[model samples]
Target: MPPLNDDAIVLRTSDFSETSMVVTFFTRESGKITCLAKGARRLKNPFDTAFDAMNVCRILYYPKSGDVLQLVTEAKLTERFRVDSTVAIYAGFHVVQLLNHFTENFSPQTALFDLTKIILNDILSLNPICRSASLEDPPEKLSRCLLHYELRLLQLVGVAPSLRECVECGEKIEVRRGARRAAFGMREGGVLCPRCRPGKTRVVSLSPEALGALQLLASPEERFWKRLQLSQKTLGEIRGVWNQYLAHQMERPVPIFQWLKR
Candidate 1:
């Protein structure tokens, strides 16, 4: 096929040969693509900046029929996100990691792309470390943000857990004590009612506030995130639920959380 022009964000890059590299990018128009960047490792390479992870660029490529990799012709950097803050840097990596794991090649994820860009911009602008430090209680706020992003990402990918009612008996759960003990059956893809928990089942405990926070995060409005708040205990509960849900769905544990724990 003839070379085509597209705008994309660099997801990853690795050395291919003496001077070239195998680069993966998620494009605004063409979705995820793996392209061979000939001579990208050379000092005088024109597409040097475009090969950096998280950098948005415009690329020209020729995709042969039934070929796994595309041949890159030209790439021009459009946005070089200078992430000076540590939190911002980690946030950027989290976005890239999620896209790499969850999305299939050539599948359109325009909403996910836009959401990631906005989140990255927010992380770059705010002092996440300082914000966490000054809080009445501090407990890995950056990690919490990452978890929130993951939950929303899962929703966008059509795998978010059902929290409204029990997936088993379709009963609306009532909050008890300070928390609501809902049985999150990973196999069933949602919560289980009290009556339906007769047999052995996997479940995650969530506080009333935590459930509310989850609902808010799953909402449609991007600006609605500003009004959302959660306590330390609630955040921890939500994180556990997200981790369990993601692991069950993906069949592999997310290592990014391990790095963030440090």
Candidate 2:
């Protein structure tokens, strides 16, 4: 067949033999794919010797059927992320993990791929030093970035969490005193209005503050990031709510959230 060429982000890399390596890439044209880079592990290899998580690169590969590995003929690095904070480092790891786990092989995810590149670029540009940096709180800021990216990814992958209304009854959740205490319906797959609250046993109270944070994260406003600030309580609740929602929806836990906690 023809050579597949695309802009891809390195999601994973593993040594396949003494001199060969298997690299997993998430590309704009192909959602997720693996290729065997022959002799890539040598001291000086033709594959640039620069495959790592978060590296954006141009890749050319030849496909093969079944369990046989596809040959990655060429890989040229386009961008590499550099962040000062350990949390930021882990956040990149989390991004790669999500791609490797959630994406389907050879299926194009152009929007998600573009957005993923943007997320990594933005994270490194901020050059987060630590949670105690003078610019902002490290964990708080990085977590918000990661959460925001997750929300966007969820949208791209057709699993966006419902925010403005109830998932069951189509009732628009009112942002007022009594109605502000909305219930997060995990199985129902979104926030449930109090009127439709009794059916689900896995429901948890989602405060307006926490919901507001989710709204901001799901928002497209560029200035929102600069103005984004979350109190510890609100952040915790948002994390908890999304954690349950994501876990229930994916039928497994999302380990990336733990990176923020650390």
The C-alpha TM-scores of every prediction are 0.87, 0.90
lDDT of each: 0.73, 0.78
Each prediction's Cα RMSD? Answer: 3.2, 2.6
Question: Residue 212 error for model 1, in Å?
Answer: 1.1
What is the Cα-based TM-score of model 2? 0.90
TM-score of 1: 0.87
Q: Model 2 segments beyond 4 Å from truth? A: 65-68, 131-137, 176-179, 254-256
lDDT of 2 by residue, 39-133 (tens): 99998888774597799989999987765678898999889876667667767888888767778887798888888898888678656345345
Number of clashes in every candidate structure? Answer: 0, 2
